[model samples]
Target chain A: MKLTIQNLTYSINDTVIVSDVGLNIKKGEFVGLIGPNGCGKSTLLKNIYRVLSPDAGSIYLDETDIRTMKSKELARKMSVMIQENNVEFDMNVLDMVLLGRYAHKKMLGNMTPEDYEIARKALEEVGMAEYEERSFLSLSGGEKQRILIARVLAQQTDFIILDEPTNHLDIQYQFQIMDILKSQDATVFSSVHDLNIAGYYCDRIIVMKKGRIIHCGAPEEVLTSQIIDELYHIRSEIRENKYTGRKQVYYIPNSANISTCAVTENL
Target chain B: MAAAGFAAMIAAMLLGSVGIQPDWVVKILANHLSRHNIFSPEWEANKEAIIWTLRAPRVVMAYVTGAGLSLCGILMQALTKNSLADPYVLGISSGASSGAVAVICYGWFRFAGAYHIMFGATLGAILAIVIAMKVSSVSNKVTATQLVLAGIAVQAMFSAITNAILYSSTTTSDKLRSAMHWMVGSLASASWNTTVYVLIISLVCTVIIRLFHTELDVLMLGDDTASTLGINLRQVKIGVIVLCTALTGSIVSIGGVIGFVGLLVPHITRSIVGSAHKRLIPASVLTGGFFVVICDMLARILAAPEELPIGVITSFFGAPFFLFLIRKSRNSFGGKNG
Candidate 1:
């Protein structure tokens, strides 16, 4: 139920994209990976999710190397929701969700009621039960993201990896999606653009700068104003909420004091 | 549905010119089938040649080719993930056209059988598909859009070459007309000898495709998801393309250049049933068979003594139906045309 990547490295045309990256997500924990644009968070996550193979390194899921596991076995153990999932076909929403059960059922077997129930429950959880008969192409951005989440939920795995799962969402849906991920019992690992959301949800935060981990600790420890300024080259005033006492990051636009660490180079 | 298709075929054969008595048709069929006659000798002796040798073989050929073409269309649509994708989508038809035209102009019958034209056409189709695959396969990915574009380029090239040959040739005008007829597609040349082969190949390919329906469904989700689900997408893509071309090329070799069956049949199937390949593939195959049989029947009866090209019949129906589908589903995926 834990994932460990050690000394992972990948290079394209001999230009290192992710170099010597090491990270871990323990069982039942929510982990967040944060970095400036192009800092290799997506790349590193891609490597772990088997979309990209690392040039040199090992990824262990529990005690076994993930590379040796059959794809079906891995699929049964973990699920991933990627960012760029636009489809050209006009699949019904329910049919789209049913595709998640593809790995679970035999090739020749008919879909059982249990499969429908799982898809229904997943849809219900995402507030999309009423939209099951609607066309997938007709959904708005947030609804589409929720349907994708429902698809992953239908996978019924012990772990889920989300790559910017709320990239195009408004604030309310963004919180709703993050809240859903936070409520899940599965070990959750996410890449996020919003540091505040990361702080609100993640049990631990991994901050990458130039393809390597620059900071790894509690959000409070790693998300300091100085570190934020150092990572993104933007000055930010950090404060605690008046009533809730939760840390918040507010940036001063075009500040000169911040040194933007081009951490994506290491990736 | 199978019974309905059978009924339509019978109706088609019965309604044709000469209005041969059903009893005579039955006796001729029985005499051939049993190799002995128990029926009245007068009707059997007179009708055997017309029913057994001519009309029956041609109609059966029509059924087989129609079914085969439709099956090819369904498979090609799923393989390329584009509804417009068909046997012609990859330029196979144009290549076969060039090959058949070359044979007719050169009078290859001196060295080959009258069926040599078919062999030449199949060879052309195979060659075209191979070249298209090679040209479009950049890196490890073969994009559908790229494949379709490559096919269009090859089709255009082949058509130009065919036209150049036609313009330069000194062959008789009769030969040119025959070549043009074959390009339009026909089951007129179909014989009992060819129907068995077409039937066996088409039926087997249809079964194999249906068996792999689950894999086909997974393929629609894109390569990443398919691979993630333990399906080796590259292997499946190649396997499907080879099967599609073989079935389609053989039919094109024999039947000429029928288009739109592959494009339109799957669309109809999708509307009736959802996009689940389990339902979509089988229904497409059956409906394809039914549609082609009906079209072939139309081709036979519409022109009476002179047979029309089956392709013309399909386009007569397919073009208008395609326009209607496009109009009806303007908000759907097929609306991308505009």
Candidate 2:
């Protein structure tokens, strides 16, 4: 249940994208990774998921080395949901979700009714059960991302990794997706693009800058104004939300004059 | 679909230059299958001979060639993750053609005798695709546009080799003429021997591909996602490539370079059955069979005894469809949002 990374480094053409990173994620922890664009958050996740091998160091799920196990065995424990934009082919939503059961099936296995039941429930969890019969390509961007999340849910792994799960979603959808991920029982490790979203849902935040981990702790400790300025070089006002009781941030542009210091307070 | 395939087969056999009776076609098939003369020969000896020997093997070849080419299309599309990929578009067909032509002109693989063309065709197909794939790939993956462009390059080169061998054979004989017929893709030389060989290969390939239906489905999700989903990426890809190349080689050996069936049939069936290979593969196989048989029948009856090459008939239909698909795909890909 514990995922450990020891001294991991990954490089492409000798230009390191993930460098000497180390961490341990305990069972059932909601961990968020935050970094500026191209700061190697995705690359670090890829290394953890075995999509890319590190030039040094190793990862273990509990006592087991991930490198020694077959991909099927690894998939049984860890599921990954990277941004899936272009499918290029049309298929029924249910069938697409059912692909998550691939690691569990035998070579000549058929899609049993039980499998369909699991897929249906997963879709329902994402509020996409009614769209199961629809062509996957016909769905909107938010709907497609939901279906992909449903696919990950159907995978039924105890641990999951998501890379920028809501990069382009509208604010309405951004909260809905975060709500769904938070509601899950799995140990969730994700790269989060929106700082406010991460602050609201994530139990702990890991901040990366220039291919290295700069800070890691509770969101309140890690997402401070100083760290935000240091990481992205932007001025930001931070406060605890009165409603949700979590940290919330509002940015201050140098050109814009602030009438009041508290942007959220007025609302 | 099965009924349609049976109907198409009957029509293909009955509508040839020799007007054979429908009853005779069935009885002839029965006799061949049972390996006994179950029905008395009420028809002329020529009619029975035409049904059992000439037309039966030709019609079977038509179906096998159709099914095999379509399967290759599905595999290529899956392999490159591009809808436009096929044996013809990827230059695998032209590679097989060049190999087959070399065998015919120089009587190469004389040691292997009857099955030499298939081996040569397979070897040529492997070589052409290796070169095409090597050229098309950027980093570790092949993009849709680069694959098609590389395919065109491979196609042009292999076609040149085939033509060069055809033109440079100093002796003028039936061997050269038969090679010419095959070069353009005709079932005129299809016999019981080659038909059995190709039929076996098609059936085996179909079964193998069927086993990977789930893997192929995952593959459509993209390479990175599929592997994380537990698909042994290397194993599935190698399996698909080997099966596609072998089937393409055998198909060329029998039917020469029949184009567009491989490109057109899978797309058509995908539209009807959706993109899951479990449904799409079987549907494409049957639909492809029906398509080729109808086309073969047309090749026979189109200009009477002077048979047009089956490729000529298929390209007449397939070329327009390919252009239409290009425009359609381009439209979807044109905007940043598509």
Top of the candidates by TM-score: 2
Q: In candidate 2 chain B, what residue range of length 10 has the lowest lDDT sum?
A: B329-338
Best of the candidates, lDDT? 2
How good is the docking of model 1, by CAPRI class?
A: acceptable
lDDT for each residue of candidate 2 in A7-32, tens digit (9 for 90 to 100): 99999998989999999999999999
Query: Which residue pairs in candidate 1 collide?
Result: A17-A267, A18-A267, A209-A263, A210-A263, A210-A264, A210-A266, A211-A267, A233-A260, B73-B262
> What is model 2's DockQ versus the real complex?
0.71
The digit string of per-residue lDDT tens for model 1 on B292-316 reads 8888888887888877888898888
Q: Which whole-number lDDT from 0 to 100 does residue B17 have in model 1? A: 63
lDDT of 2 by residue, B1-338 (tens): 87898899988889876777788899988987998999987898888888888998999999999989999999988877778888998899999989988887688898887889998998889988788878877765666667768999999999888877877874567556665665569998899999999999899999989888998999878888998888888888888889988999999998888988988999999999999999999999999999998899999998997888999998898989988887777744434323
Instruction: Output the lDDT of residue A28, model 1.
Output: 95
Kindly report which residue pairs in candidate 2 clash with one another.
none
